[model samples]
Target: MEKGSNHTPKALEKMRQRKWSKATRAKMQGKSHSAETRAKMSASHSGKTLTPEHRENIRKALLGHKISPETRAKIGKAALGHTRRLGMKHTPETIAQISATKLQPENRAKARAKKLGSNNPAWQGGISREPYGWEWDEPLRESIRKYDGYKCRVCGVPQMECDVALNVHHINYAK
Candidate 1:
């Protein structure tokens, strides 16, 4: 479901013909959800992209609509608190609820599957398992460490602070 692409006539007709259950319609009619439910609903839709057809339909629907003054005033009134809420911090419970689905084992497995191997952003064509170059000996590592002042080049943590000797890394990861 991307921009510039749309369903065929058959698919569109099928979607149009789909009917909601009476119970579902009754449940949704003239009813507003609690704040927690609203928050959860908002969180679920956060990263989804609307297709171009949906955008066009919305544009066409609003093209010639005239807003009555009373309706316009109500809309403006409702938006007044939106700016105030922009920088508000979420409570611990809210944060936990938003992240609950992400912490589930099935979701974790799906995320891992999505990012595996060549699909991953950091993928380097399986070079990580390659053996080091012949010249990569312990003496050379020690020399490099000594040359670097026996500290981590990135974090500046000295060798003595670590339980083990500092590890020397190849900058280009060629080794």
Candidate 2:
């Protein structure tokens, strides 16, 4: 295919459907480019920078693309044992520079506004803070502890045998 040539969806689908013989696939398997060729390819694109428009175009092109499970597994396997920046730490000067950028008045205001209740993206209308139930009180907890013989169901240890206080937890929150 020529560089920058248009490949319509139908053409691309046809290419994907076409399967080469096993021998043809095997011929190119486990092959590496020559050192000189690799050097030339690297040098051709060294120190290149993409314009803002080009970056935006690439981002938009990939916005809604989904990777197959096979591809995702391969990526996970490839990254299993790699650490990109092992033991790396910013110097005091670099830390100061970052703090100065974050401490700007506009940046501080934006951060503070984002953390405001209801205004925050994670806000859930304060449902988490609502009381559980009238029955979910200290008396009910003590009754459950007595019913369980003052012992942990999982550990089988009596509350009197341990220094830490024992708690009776509800098995079902909705109840």
Candidate 3:
């Protein structure tokens, strides 16, 4: 018996209370830890550096994991066929609209340049001097009145009933 176990007071205490087994002692010790300590332990383990041999082992494990060329070709063929089927059903105008929306990088750049030029006073000279486009037009007012049924376009309330004059707004000022 251990020195503590041989003592009369300790032996008496052990007799009075049931002694925990080794497995029970281990389980109790495991359950004694606080949640904060467990999180810190998990975080510390996550930062551990793997050995070169371990990395090599992982690489070897994933060596044959890629999709084969034949499988890739099959997937590619299926996708192309699916796209062709979908595209074939679309009307020419629909296709044209879709194609127009997908502007090339160069086209996008030109558009951005044009927009910036129009907005920036420094580049104002680069654009046309004509001030008569969509802005400040009697025709625009007429169109807005027609679209809104002679109602205030700002609040969508009737223009005849409202106190304020209907302000024709180009919803997107970017235009």
Span of ten consecutive residues with least summed lDDT in model 2: 166-175
**CA-RMSD of model 2:** 16.1
Lowest-sum lDDT 10-residue window in model 1: 15-24
Q: Looking at candidate 1, what is the lDDT of residue 144?
A: 89
Q: Which scores better on TM-score, 1 or 2?
A: 2
Candidate 2 per-residue C-alpha lDDT over 70-165 given as tens digits, one digit per residue, 9 for 90 to 100: 999999999997997789899999999999999999999999988999987888987654666555777878888888888988789999999976
lDDT of 3: 0.72
lDDT per residue, candidate 1, 1-175, as tens digits?
Answer: 6889989999888666665656557877998999999999999999999899999999999999999999999999998867876778999999998799799999999999999999999999887646876566889888888899888987889999999998777345555
Ranked candidates, highest lDDT first: 1, 2, 3
lDDT for 31 in candidate 1 is 83
Q: Tens digits of per-residue lDDT for model 3 on 1-175?
A: 6666565897778765655656556776746568999898998899699999999999999998998899999999888746546545888999898788767777788867776855666665654536445465778767867777887545667777868656666454433
Looking at model 2, how many pairs of residues clash?
Answer: 0
Among all windows of ten consecutive residues in candidate 3, which has the lowest summed lDDT? 127-136
- TM-score for each model: 0.32, 0.34, 0.21
Name the candidate that leads on TM-score: 2
As for TM-score, the candidate ahead, 1 or 3, is 1
Residue pairs with clashing backbones, model 3: none
The TM-score between candidate 2 and the true structure equals 0.34
To one decimal, what is the Cα RMSD in angstroms of model 3 from the true structure? 23.0
As a whole number from 0 to 100, the lDDT of residue 141 in candidate 3 is: 68
